[model samples]
Target: MNKVLKQAIRAILPTWRTTPVDVMHRESGIPPVAQLLEARRIRFSARIKSLDPAHPLRPVLLPRKYASEPLPPLQTAAKKEAAEEFNAWLESVSPLTVIVYSDGSLSEKGAAGYGFTVHQNGRSLRQGAGRLGPAEVFDAEARGALEGLKAALRLPQSASQKIVVCLDNIAAARCLRGQPSDSSQGVFLAFQAPAKRHRQTDIRWIPGHSNIAGNEQADVLAKVGCTHPEPMNAAPTLAFLRRGAKRQCKDVARAWWNETAPDKYRSLNLDFPNCCPPELDLPRPVLHHLLAARNHHGDFADYHERFGHDDAKLTCSCSWRKSPTHLFYCRKVDSRHRMRLAPSPAVAIDRAIGRDFEKFVKLAQSSSFFEKICPCL
Candidate 1:
């Protein structure tokens, strides 16, 4: 099945048979058959997990699990509104009221971390930071909120005293307000116990990077946690694993192309996994001509001779061999049409195969331009 798919992709790219599979996959941005099947399986499993408890297929698909505790009350507001509300609430609260700020960070290298700061009135009381190793930012956010709540609970407070946990990630706040179904289920469950015991506890959302002091402090602490020497030995989330898989596939393909791609193809210097190139949106025949020119595989004397097309013309009307580079210098093509594409021959060829598509599409679709260059067309 993948072989058929590969043939179809080659036809679309209009590349030569000698083109490496890695190059084809890199240019097309289509994963192999196995990767696609694995992605489908992951999606199916997630669907099963989202089904209702009473669903008949739920038990058949997955083993029965204990029900999660009800989530704490959540308060959310728009960015500007949230900042204003939070500031007003801070001014009105007593010195005894506990306010906790939490944040999460993910590094470019995929390390994840969480940070929290617990405060009373305007004074900082406690702060915590930790590494979650190979985890998603979502997990880090939930864990940070959980740690902040735990620190707030440890502080001495009356039964009626208000405890508010503030975070910038609204999705994490909403998840804590609902059932726990993601990879961070254990952390959410742990948070539920203390929150349920304290009736005055509430989770609140605030806009991140809005110049809030506590949020900024928490953000710094999270970055610090990312540089920690040791990481927590926690199981990676399903989402994290899925992302890693796709990234690995692309990395392997890129490495293969860099090490073994033909010199002619390598000279183009195209990036691997060139997903959604603007040229793909052009009309089909125009796209075909553009790709053929880029790959050096269309209506050229060398290509025809290699494929044993004896009847095809070997040279242009100007008596020069029809080749990819000849399109730039062929005097048989009208100089006006050539200059419309580019002022210089080098720039014209670069624009034809480069990332910019606007000029290339115009030149390719221009009446009689390709026909003048290659009479065989």
Candidate 2:
């Protein structure tokens, strides 16, 4: 297997200078090409340590046989009314439950990571981890749940085992379990094989960032796992794919703007649109109307002239044609009225338009009244 993989890597990687590994390491602070190659070779060559219960790495960190006989039961959040009743039942049934915890994390810098630990009978039976380059938080979370469940299945199977997979994300839980019982189904059916061996597999929802020990541990582990040299297993799910597609679209949009946007916009100081298109900051319909009017493409006088509205005259109330350029100095609208409502309504806006188009867009987003002066309304 190792030899076949080595041959495949050699065949798959590009020629030296243009190789992805070479380009990846060209960035400052990245490891040298030789060191990176060696690491990859070792990673691909070495047999992965299994997550089986008998594996040396399977035991919980700081393993010690506690004389306590059994650890405390993992608790789920409860409403005020059920708080007391829920704890009483949770402790009673914990011994029959194998609580599995999973979590994923993404840093502000876009680093993606996930971690999971399986504990039963007061001992962590297994721990699994993985990570990715900058990615969406939702994708990381979904992968955490999916891979955690898959890892739990690799543990020693027993008919007596009652697995309760705990994840803080409710949406991810619903996607996995399919339904409420051990029989719920969702996007992935990987849990079915483990279900047959274990008497039951339940996905339990817990509140995130609320300091639940298992959940917290999972969160911390995911963050730590982000530093791993290579991700363990990145299984793409529907959500992950969807996020990837959206990211691709954003990238394409940015590229188009960079390549084809007016030269005048080069000095614009604008924030990246994390959730929407670059130039659009309003609701879709409103954005459409505003853009049409600004570009002389809507039901304006200039547009009507070309499309032949009843009045084919190209003129505004101020005698200047109702066009985008005409709006700039048409005198149809007084700068004083707009000044009262602009971010720098009096004169700063015109300055921004000359020096920084992005700053103008940002200001424009907030001042619809001022936009009327230049079809920007």
Candidate 3:
């Protein structure tokens, strides 16, 4: 599959047969088939783990011990409604029920934090917040749910006291009701312990950024947690690990390119192993011209000679040897066009193929411009 995908990439890039596989892959901004399959497998595994107990494939995929243990029934409220309706519902909840509003925040530096405010009988009972180092926002959300449950359990309560945990993240709220499958499995499991003891516990999802007082307070506390001096030790979640793997892959590919890529390609100073090049979203023909020019595999006399093509012409119409660098100097091209290129050959090529790609595309699409630049094409 990888071999086939590489072949397709080469065709799309219109690069020479001898172009490095890594160069084609990077230029096309496509991952290896293996990497794609691994990502899919990870997603499928998470889905299977989150499946309902009654799902036929769930029993088959899971171990016998896990398959037989029925997931505890969790009361959930995830309906989408207007802010007015939600406020009305909140005001109508029984005064005896403990309402815990939880929220999660992610810092710019990748720190995750959780915060919760517990309330009852129209008054605040307590508030808590904490940081989880090097974790995802989803992990923080799950942690918030767990911590909120713990806080509600610690409150002085009568026999009729029930608990409702409200979270702004629907995914986190829903995940709590299902069997634990993600990186937050431990936190979710901890939440289940208290929830089982207090059978009247309910998990609810509220719209985020809707200006509710409790939700806003929880948001502020979560931001405070993000700035905490010390973060608690927490294992990296599956999402975090996947991101690391992707970065490592790119690093490896870049190292290989630096060591083995031809000097001609290296001179352009293009970002190697980039998964999303600027030209990627452009029209296919436009992208093809850019890649071909960058790789020096299109309409060049030296390229044709190297590949033993019959119609190879060593010199341009103005008698200069046809080469990748000759495009900026070709006298047949209009002085106006030449003025558009940078004085430095490397910068000129880089801009033509990358930085100024849209302009390059316009020129490439013009028959007069393309013919003057490369008559052999």
Candidate 4:
């Protein structure tokens, strides 16, 4: 539409339910335009009110993030002597010490789940798992680490005993180290923050599936937690927030397209605005000019008259009014130049727009068709 004319219609209508009218009466500032716009707005508003209400778009929330250190490499092989020493260190830990192993699992449906096992002197002290709702693997991994660290920090261990939380996911371990990488920030906010206050707690990363009993137990619990039937805490991670935002935008856009697209535009009709349908993917200007010649804003006597080129007379070289009506009915141009239209001139113009749009799409299928006939492509 012409910007000024659209604004005039908007000014009269309450903006919620205004529909496009036959804008051949293009006097945007005139009283007739306001009257026409009000009538159309009322009709469109009633129609929309009668239809089912559009589904609501949901909003997403996200956790706060802090500037943390860069991440470390996730997994490294343990050499023969080092592996033995690491196993020995685990074996020789004080009986009063608290140690935890955590893991995360992502379901086929992308549900986030976390699990942890707390042990004292190589015996199970407590074990639990929880779901993080819809989330990515890394975010779930971080959540598991936070939960394990949280558990380890609060345990009834001796004051002299060391507190250690281990996890196979290197990314989550880095988050525990206070590095905020993409979506793991939520874990820090919801669980890791409290654990951070207790400085005695230490986080360790070990190679996954290294025959470590605690780590294997955590891995199983993580998988089980993901498909748990009960509702779990759905803390908004950065990844979940991003997904929600993208979905909301797409839904709103689709709804708007459905609501405002021209009623005459059928399933296959492309939107050909201003003589060029970018969606048509055409390669030449011939069809563009050809299509525009049938509209009110065309390079015809009616369009020229409206812009004060003549004395508002729309009569053409064929001695007929060269308005949109004449384009469909005019015999002087070509006997075969026919356009699909209704009996009413206004409706004919509206309906023809969709019909021509579809025609243009079909014409555009052959990329080199225009290039063969017309040198300028």
Candidate 5:
């Protein structure tokens, strides 16, 4: 067995970096690497003592008891036994009544999408999706959890019901389980909406791509929701569970702006939009002035909050706005109106545009509003 292990290690060396001694010990259980090499039992130049499990080189060296146990010497074999032991322990305690899997994703930076599937007795109970915009990854994960619970609520209730929510994301499960940070606003609010219903959920972590059935399905749905660029209904699936079905106080004006405004402002590509007005409508003349300040890099006689003009050559940074040039340079009445308006309106407009843009991006990323915005390039 030792000689066979040496040959296996040499053959495996082309693919892996493990030492022959390490391979032999991992393969042949009885004599161990050191004893086999000391007895001229294996082919290797290094001293037998160097191959000792007690040597400082190996971190995964098994204890004497580990070798004595009726187990294979390979670390993989040991881990399999440990996993079986753990599975036995869990089965003894709870018996795993249900497995729920959930996932969250974002198409753009601000949008969030999530999906979940619930299973028990080898059957699916429910699954769902939530779409919104301008939320972070943490927020998306929370949405997955909250939305997952909502899906589970569609099933029959029982006192012995034990649900295991397998999450593709660690942050989300950790956040919900109180292992790390708190859940995000979308998730927190989603959880609150359905809290009265799904009272028996247990959050759990599972390694992705390990053939977890429900987890893979949930992942596929999450990908679809995240990658799909079309606009959606923008309703959280858990909303029906909320008391009186009262919706969160969303700013409709912000939503409208995001739906209509160009991507340059909403996507944070430039600083000029952030400086736009928020509450009040901006006049046409001042809009041009701010656009000019942003694009042409010009100076003004007085730097109004919106307009930064460089009058020496009369250039500014308004790259998107349509200008006939005479609008700013003309000594006409309209150009005078452009210069005389209160700076407050322009300031308010710029700020509002910025805020609305951010909110739009966030909400659009949700599973509900998956719309793609083609900015005016």
Candidate 6:
């Protein structure tokens, strides 16, 4: 096509959604001229050569035609066809609609590249590309969807309208339906603002390549987004790294405190602050160990008097066994279990370590001094 023709097409296509194609074609009246040019080319006539003056007639812009006049209701095969056609034409003119489709590409690192494509309709409106970081395939899919949606919304569209994002990735679709992507913070926020104002505002997922125009375009767009530079952020990848670093720091702290802290540090003489009630006994091993450590230094007869007899045994008034199990398991005395009866040698150490780590976490979270001391984390 000539430059004039290309420019004209761009100008008129933006109105195709609301305008009837028959009306548009009649208004454009370019078919006869196009046919005439085709005839001239077929004949290889001398007149065709002569028509090319220093400047030929400026090309007439043609409005787009909807594939079907009466759109079928949405269901069944016919409705599907109509929906596909309607969406195709709408994409051509709506300008706000961006479709992205994605498939995974695998590598030896147990990694996958999300193959993607972006399109407005049959026309390739724009493209994007990206590479997955250390995330699962589903995570990659969600990231791609989020990226594509962001790209579309950032385009020059009417401000009143929210962009419709179509994707072929089922995992991505599920993720969007379930939870917003933490990585796509900007896009997630962008979508959230309109959600408060409108009930129908949302990104949509269509089946892949089911002859669906938007889905096909999305597939192309996703591929482009995959290869293109990631959307702007101060440290998009760094957020993940920071999160990982935080977890590693916590693990290291816990391990070190367990290995080095004394039994007293683990069983800090407190009454299980910030823990479940003592009545619940909710696996509060550290609290139990702490109680045991404090009580273990006292008289065994006192421990027995507090929690020695089972309720059932007491009710029956029977002589039960006098083993450590009788004091701990049978009597359900946590102090007895923590102080003496636990078979694992590591249990006491673990309790001691946990108590110290808990204190450290609290102090670190609250104290400016602690923050300065461990700036590496």
Q: Report the lDDT tens digits of candidate 4 across residue range 265-365.
A: 33324332322233235333543433343333454464565567654445545466554334455454333444445486555554444454444334323
**For each candidate, what TM-score against the reference?**
0.74, 0.47, 0.69, 0.43, 0.35, 0.31
Q: Which wins on lDDT, candidate 3 or candidate 4?
A: 3
Deviation (Å) of 138 in candidate 4: 1.5
lDDT of 4: 0.57
> How far off is model 4, as Cα RMSD?
14.2
Give the TM-score (vs. native) of candidate 2. Answer: 0.47
Clashing pairs in 4: none
**Predicted candidate 3 versus true structure: per-residue lDDT over 209-256, tens digit per residue:** 888788889999998888886544655676566655656666655665
- lDDT for residue 85 in candidate 6, whole number 0-100: 59
Clashes of 2: 10
Report the candidate with higher TM-score, 2 versus 6.
Answer: 2
Kindly list the per-residue Cα lDDT of model 5 for residues 6-99, writing each as its tens digit: 6754453221222224322222222333443443422222223224356656433322222133522112334345445434534564433766
Candidate 6: minimum summed lDDT over ten consecutive residues — where? 368-377
Over the stretch 1-377, how does candidate 1's per-residue lDDT look in tens digits?
79987987787675667656655665576656665566566656655554446874653232334436754434456678778887887898888888889999998878888999998878889999988956788888899999999888888753667888889887888766556645677787788778878878787888899888999999999988888765547666655665666566566556655776656555566665525555567777666566666666777888899989888888877889887766556776655555444576666566656555455566545635565556554
From the highest TM-score down, the ranking of the candidates is: 1, 3, 2, 4, 5, 6
C-alpha lDDT values of all predictions: 0.72, 0.51, 0.72, 0.57, 0.45, 0.41
* Candidate 3 residue-wise lDDT at 238: 61
Give the range of the ten consecutive residues with the poorest summed lDDT in model 1: 58-67
Cα misplacement distance, residue 221 of candidate 5 (Å):
0.5
